[model samples]
Every structure is written in C-alpha cells, then in structure tokens.
Target: MSRRRQLHMFDNTTESELHEQTFTDAVPTSQRYLHRRGETYYFKRKIPTDVPHAFGSKGETHWQSLKTNSLQEALRRLPAEIEAFDSKVRKARESRRQGKVPVASRPRTEGTTKYLQEAHIPSIIERFEYSLLQTDMEERRVMEDDAELDIRLADFEQGLKLKKRAAAREEFSHVEDVAQVLLEDERLIAPPGSAARTLLLRELMRADIQTLQKQCDALRGNLFALPPTVPVAPRDLPTMQTAFEAWRQSQDKDRTIDAYGRYVRQFESENRELPMASISLETANKFRDYLHGCDLDRESIINCVGGLATLWDFYERKSNRITSNPFREVQYDGLPRRESSVDRRRFEVSELAILFNSPVYLGQHKLKGQVKESAYWAPLLGPFVGARIEEIAQLRIADILRINGVWCIRIENLEHDQRTKNMGSHRLVPMHKEVIQCGFLSYVAKQKLAGQTHVFPSQRNTNKYRLWSNALTKWFGSYMNRIGLEDPRLVYHSFRFTFKRQCTVCGISDEVRDALTGHWLSRNSSNVYTSDADRQYPFPAVARGIKKLRYDELDLRHLHVADPFDQVDRAWKY
Candidate 1:
C-alpha cells in the first residue's frame, strides 16, 4: 500500500542480509528497471479499487498473480519482490559508475539526419535526388579500380549535356538521357524553375560551339567504351496454367479455391504431370467430359468450367498475350430440381400405445438419466422432431432460448452463416412440452454445456454428423419393420414431413409452421394478406401443437402415446 524507500544498494553482504521486502508502486513510471533475479527488467504496478474497470481494480493485470490463495502465502512472496527491487537499484548504480550509457540514450546519427532532411532538390532544373545505392553496387565495382571509375565518370558527364533547344518535349530538354524518372513529364513545364533551366540551356548551346572537340571526345568515350544494357522484354504468351495460377492467387474465398483446384485437376491426361494452357475449344470440351465422368452433377461441372472461363478472362485483362476465353459459350445442364415430400408417419391411437410400451424406446434406459439422455430419448425425438442429423447432433445447449414465457429451439449452420440458404433453414421450432418434461434442461446441465459449447459432443467434432443419415435411416426403418408395418421408406427427412402433416392435423396455419421449420412462405398467399399477420394470434391453438396431452386417469391405468395409458398386464414380461 506504500512506496518503498530508495536504497543506495551496495556492499553485497549487507544488501543480501537486509530486508528484501519489495512494494509495488501505485503509479508505475515507464523508465526501465533491472530486477535482482537473473537481472531481468520488469514492469511493476498496483491498481486501486477506485479505478474504473469491470473487475475490481485491485485485481492486478501486471503480475501473473500473488500465487497464494491465502494471506500467509502473499506475505511469504513479498520479500522476494523486495530483493528483486534492491538488486535493480544496485545494477543501475554500478552501470552509472562504470561510465556506461544505455544504447537508447546515445547521440543521434549525424550523417543520416542530414541525408533525410533533403532527398530531392532542384539542380539545373536543379532537381537533386538521393541516388539509390545498389545493395551490391560497391562490391561489383571493386574489381574495376580507378580506371573503371574514369570510364563511369566520363559516361555520366556526357549523359548530363543540355541538348540544343531542339527537343519539342521541352520538359526533358536538359539531361541528355533519362536515368531515373520520378515525377511524370506532364507537370514539369509550368514549374517556376523551368524558365531558369531554359535560359541556362540557351547559354550552354553558345558555349558548346567554343569547346566542340571536348564535347565530341566525351560523347565518343561513352558510346564506344560501354556496352549498352538492352531492356529485356517479358515472355510473349501467358501459358494456360500460369495464367490460372495468377487467377488462383486473386481469388479470396474457399469455394473459389476448391473450384479452381478441381479445374486444374480436370487437365489430367492432357498434361498429367503439369497444368498447361488450353489450345482450342475442343480441349475445354474434353475437360468438361472428364468432370462428368467423375460423376459431378451439372451444377458442379458448370462451376469448374465457369471458374476456368473466368480465370482466362482475368488473364486477358492482366496481359495482352492471351487472346480468348476457351470455356466461353460452353453449355452444360444445371442441377435437377428437388421435389419436397412429407413424412405422415406418427403414433396412431393404437401405435402410440405400443410405442409407450415398446421395448425399443423404453425400459431401464427410460428410467430418467440412468444413462446418457441420448441412449433413451434419441428414438422418440428422432422419430417426432424429424430434424436433420447434424442439426440435432451438434445442437448447442444455449440455442434453446427461454424467451418471454416460451421455450424455443433454434437451429443454424454454415449455410446460415453465409446467408446462402433459404430463410426456412435458420429457425426456432417450439419444442413439445413432453420434451421439456422429458429431461432437456437436465441433459444440458449434466453435460456442462449450457453456455457456449455443443449440447452433444464427441472426442472429436468431425463425427457429429457422420452417423446421421445412415443411422436415422436404419433406426427408423428397423422400427417400422420391427412392428407389423408396410412402410420402411421413412428417414430423417421424414421428420420434417411428419411435423408438417401433424401441424396440418392440428389446424395451425401454414405460415407459422413453415417459419417454425423454415419452409418457404407461400409467395402467392403472402400477397393476399390474412388476419394471421395481425398483432397476434390466440395462444391456445399454439399450445395444442406444443404441449403434451394429459390423460384424465389414475393408477397408471391410461398412459398414452396418443393414449399413454392402455394397461398391458406385466408389460415388461417379455
């Protein structure tokens, strides 16, 4: 709570034997300090409770922790902290006595400061610039010695001539050759110094007549002495694969990357070991066949071809070397339309009784949390909710919102993240009260997943949906076959069908149910607005769809599926 006094730390015996109790400052100064342990520098601070932050301000963000959960441990560590401070004080004093200054406190670089103050200035047109020193220029010129320097100096002087006022592009009239062009030529004429350069040029022309031979000698020495550096031209044609690679780097999405990677693979057999540019339309068509042969649907085939065509267009834009888009006008069929169907399967009055008493969905597993909730109720909800496997398997504990007075289950996925799927895909379906009673909250709490983690998890998350389709198909199929039923066609998608058909039977309006399950609103009926869009609907109708029906019976004489209490004598005798 109080600042420690500064000690003139010296005499190692007295320092080590004295109290080494370090106290943190209420306000820390940024100046560096050496700590006693390993001579390490550390930032030390103490925050008061009155300071504003979410956590009580006494909770320090600087020190890792006081380490002791108890006050005794805290007092135990304070001395070591003090010892560290004393060591730092001793080191600072020793450094100053040795006549050493920290590198940070050393003098400013004199030559570098002056060089940076002016990099470019005006020369005849008076533009003086900091010449770029080639990183290896000095080493390269080392072998030449003074003779080479003479040759370079002569060339530089010859290149510095003020040409006779003949260049119509008068901005470039001085400086016989363009060396480094910084500013564009368009703005140089109206410059205030241009008039000065013009007057200087006219005088130089008159003087050049007087020393003609020296000018000629200088020009000859430069021209005959040095081999001119020929400007290298870029490669003529952009090879197909090279252009595609440049196209790939330009893509900024995962889908585009996958699309391009597939297109590159499509070139197998043409250049199996290497990607090459397509020469003609026939090559592109042949590649299209290869994609089809791999059993790619029409939409996927179009994706690969369309990706290539776009890549070629990008190539044409970047370099004039490419002439045409090889995949342009290439036609292929698109994906087939999907027909939506409904699952009408549910517990009938008699079948419902059988399910409640059925060995498959009940027994010790049904004794309420005797095992994992999934071991028992996955069958019931698996049949009733009609949800997709991952949607159910990866459900987070928090997605069930207890909003207002109602509990609703929200479903979402990567498709929802990108906003690509239809509105129906992301929704909150009000769960039936039977489920609320059947251990939903208890399961979430048991798994310790109420906040941010998945309600159902595995040792690894990749397996979340792996058992979905095939498992659901077999689970529901065997149930139908196990009982005396003709239907084995039911799968997880049938769950959606079951809910909708049930919603219809309950006489609930189509709009609310569709939104619950994320089905499309009837665009036609939406235009003809109904009272359903009014302030609100009566709650009783909704309760029928979501609450479990209670039987008016006693002594477990009449439990129900649709009727949960059909008494079967010695139900588990089998």
Candidate 2:
C-alpha cells in the first residue's frame, strides 16, 4: 500500500504482464474469439457439427495461441487466422457439392439394362454361334485376335498392379465374380438337349465378353490419360564422344580438355558411344561400377565420374542434347582420408642416399649415356628445386638463366613441347647451391653450346597433351623399382616432398616455398600481399630464400655423372 512497496512490486512485474496491463487499460475485454490468459492472447472459434465432411472433426472449437502479449500483435494475427478459417469453410462446402452427381449428366437408364438382358444378349449369342459355325480358318483368325486383346489386357493389369491400385483391383475382381455368377446360373448348367441351357450359356458368354471389353476400354483410358508428350525430333543428337567434343570446345584449359578426353575415351571404349538421350543416371552409375571393377584408384574413379557429370551438366544447360545431368546425383567415394597424408613421405636422408646412389643417378644408365639429360638431372633437380617431374624434364635451355645474379629455372608453357599445370605453375625457382655445386648450370651451358633447344632432348612428347615428360614418368617408376624402393607412392614425384620438407625445416615462409614450387598461394594472406607488384619481394630476395635451403647432413657429392652426350654418340652409328 506504501509508495515504495508499490514501486518494488512494479519492479518485479514481467514484460509480458506489463504489456498486457497497458493493452487492457485501454479496453477491458477483447472482441469475440479473442481472449487473454496469463499474459498472452488466444483465438477461439467453434466448428459447427453441421459443416461439410471435408472440414473434419466438426463441432469442436479451433484454438490458436497468439504468442505475443501486446494488443497490436493479437490484432495483426486475427485477420490471417480468420481468412484461413473462411478458406477452409469454403473448400469444405465446395467439396461437399462436388460429391453429388448432377442430374443432367446422368444417362437415361430406364430400359437400357432390361434391353441388354432381353434383346442385346440374344443378338450377340446369335452372332457368336453363326461366326463359330462359319469355318475352321475363321475360328483360328478370331482366336488369334482374342489372344492379342488378352495380352494387351494382361499388360494393363500388370501395370496397374505395379502402381498398387488396390481399389481398381477390387473393382475388377468384383466384375469377374459377377460374370462368373451369371455363367453359373441353373439355366446355363443344364444337361444336353435343353434349349434353355444353350440360350443361357450363349447369353452369359456374350455378357462376359462385353464385361471384358468394357474393362479393357476403361484400363486403356486410364493408361493413356497422361499429358501429351512433346515429340522429340530425330535431330541427329550427338553421341557421348560428340557431346564431349562440344563441351571441350568451350573449355579454356588445354590440360583439362586432354584429361577430360581420356575419361570420355575410356567410357566410350567400355560402353560404346551412347546417344545423349540414352545416357541416363543408371548408365552413369554403371560406368562408375565398371571403373571400380577395373581396379582404377579412387582418384581416377572420382575423376571419371566428375568428368562425366561435368559434361552432362554442360550439355544439360547449354544445348537441348540431354534432358538432365545423369551423373549429378552420383556419389563419389571420396579419396581415402588416411591415404592422403601417407601417399607420399618426405625422403629420409637414407632414402635419398639410396635414390641418388642408383646407376641412373650416377649417369651410367642407357639414356643419352646419362648426358645429365632428364634421367640424370630430373631426379637431382626435383629434390633441389621441388619442380614437378614433367616440368623438370620438359625444361628448355631458355628456361634456365640468371635472374639478378642468381641462376633460376623459369617454369612456363612457352612452347608446344612445354606446359605448366596452371598459371600459378609459371614461376622462377632459383637454383639451389647444392645443384650449382654439382655442375647443373655447367650441364645447361653444355646443352646450349651443343645448340640443343630443350635442356633434356632425350625426353620426347609422344602424346596429344604435349606432355613431353610422360615417358620420363614411367622410366622413373622403373628406376625406383630397380633401386629397391618398393613403396608404390615413392616414385620420382616424391622428390617434391623432400624439397618441401627441407624448406619447412629451414624456416622458409610458406609464401616463399609456394612461389618456388609454383603452388597457388592466394589462400595465404601474406602470399597475396607479397604477390602485389608494387610491394612484391624482389627476385634477389626470392633467390636468397631458395639458396637458404640445404641438405648438408647427407652428402650427395658422389652423384657426379660423366658426360651424357658422349653416351648418346656411342649408342648408334647415326
């Protein structure tokens, strides 16, 4: 009752209670169907029992709780609820009216049933008897026609069964039962010489035939009731190969096009060139399964399916060749998570010793008498510079030069015989001191002196992709095997791992390493800032970062090879 006590009580009041009090202070009570309980508003309306059956659970009142305590909130909610209720009531009434058949639409049936029983059945029976007695040839012809109709009816019934049309099945079975009952009537089951028996049998048989005819007609109507199909023209739709070519024409990456071509070719080789219309989701899955069966690695399988999906997506939107991308929904069994890190291991000093001490590394192998060509130098260069196998093998003499007083291997796709993986792959990787000490620049100078265009002329481009070092990749595999390095993953490319590992050990910034290796470094903010031309690190600074890397713990000074040009000269008389 005291002022302080009243203020204390007001302080304890909830927001909703305060809101409700403010609303009710203006109006004591709400309109019909709107009521307050606690601090919230509610809408209540009774559904009359006399309403149409579609309304469902009539005579029960419908209630909706308007969550807000404010009067304005309740007012905002009321109109929408009222409109919905009105719509339900209108729909229920409309549905009730639809249930009743219009008198005008009903056919005149006063004499039709009676006429069918008395006259129509007799006429059909007479015709059937006359036709049966005509000839053996005529009987056979009629039987064949009946068999054909029965086959069509069976197909329709089976389709309905597959659709799970239980009501239709029950209705059809009821008609059959009625036909059977008519056939089993006492007049139709009499002994021979009874004219009544013959008449009943013929009449019932005619009725059964008519029943079957009506059922067939109804089923046929239902079967063909689908919306009219747009006729597809015989527009010389492209095969899978042709479609692939069309898609490839739009792609900008030459390597991507070549890789896509491999997948498409392999698909065609196995499945034959499928017309775009015939290439479906099922076929895509089948190809995936086939790839799995062929024992292709997980990455290969993913690439195959992804390539197909990409092509299908291209055609699905750009041209009217395909209805949909069949491979869109295909789930790729992603690369094995644990296998990723384990796939390549950084070369241990011991492993590096084994690799560099091999006959090929010593320049004693068959290729160009180990002219420090791809075979001799690629392995040595990959570990020092972290270049890809192909990149090292396909290097032209022009690619090796001094940048700001430091020798650099300039990676780029400047000729048909050379290609970098991507734009980021074009970079300048400075020569490591160990490589320079081992006479790499000396090898380059010698190749240049001999007027060689490519630094490694022994590695040739025999493929359509202009992958000059593809054969070198296989040779490296064989050499690795010969050296007793049994791991499937520790091929020539593992040298990249060794180089990157040494870089990390030397505390090289990732941006510097990425720049040297031609890896996309945009994901790193520092790399992005560093790459900006105005504030970019100078070429000499980058060269210093490259020079900072060293592997002195394991000595590779024993890998000195004899001149490779001399070996090539002795191999043939040319």
Write one digit per residue (lDDT tens) for candidate 1, span 106-225: 332211111100111122122211121221233334645766656655654554453433333344444422311322321222232454344444433443332333334443443212
Task: List runs of model 2 lying over 4 Å from the truth.
Answer: 1-235, 250-262, 265-290, 293-296, 316-326, 333-338, 341-344, 360-372, 463-466, 521-541, 559-574
Which whole-number lDDT from 0 to 100 does residue 44 have in model 2? 72
Please provide, for model 2 over 1-574, each residue's C-alpha lDDT reduced to its tens digit, 9 standing for 90 to 100. 4434332433333455445533432332223566666667777777744342223332377777889776567767877777787787675555333221011212322112221122233433433333323332243336546566577679646644543443334233333343334434212223333454444444544444544344456434432121143222112235566657779878665678867766776666555444555567888888777665544556667777888778877866677544667777777654342376455676787888888887776657767522336777787887888988878877888887765566688887787656767655777888877787666777777767677888887666666665777777777778788889878778777888888888989888887877777663443446544433223335676787887898877787775445423322232222
Candidate 2 positional error at 291, Å: 3.8
Candidate 1 lDDT for residue 164: 35
Model 1 compared with the native: what TM-score?
A: 0.36
Number of backbone-clashing residue pairs for each candidate, in the order shown = 18, 2
Candidate 1: minimum summed lDDT over ten consecutive residues — where? 110-119
Point to the candidate with the largest lDDT: 2
In model 1, where do residues sit more than 4 Å from their true spots?
1-358, 364-372, 382-386, 412-424, 437-454, 457-490, 500-511, 519-574
lDDT of 1 at 395: 64
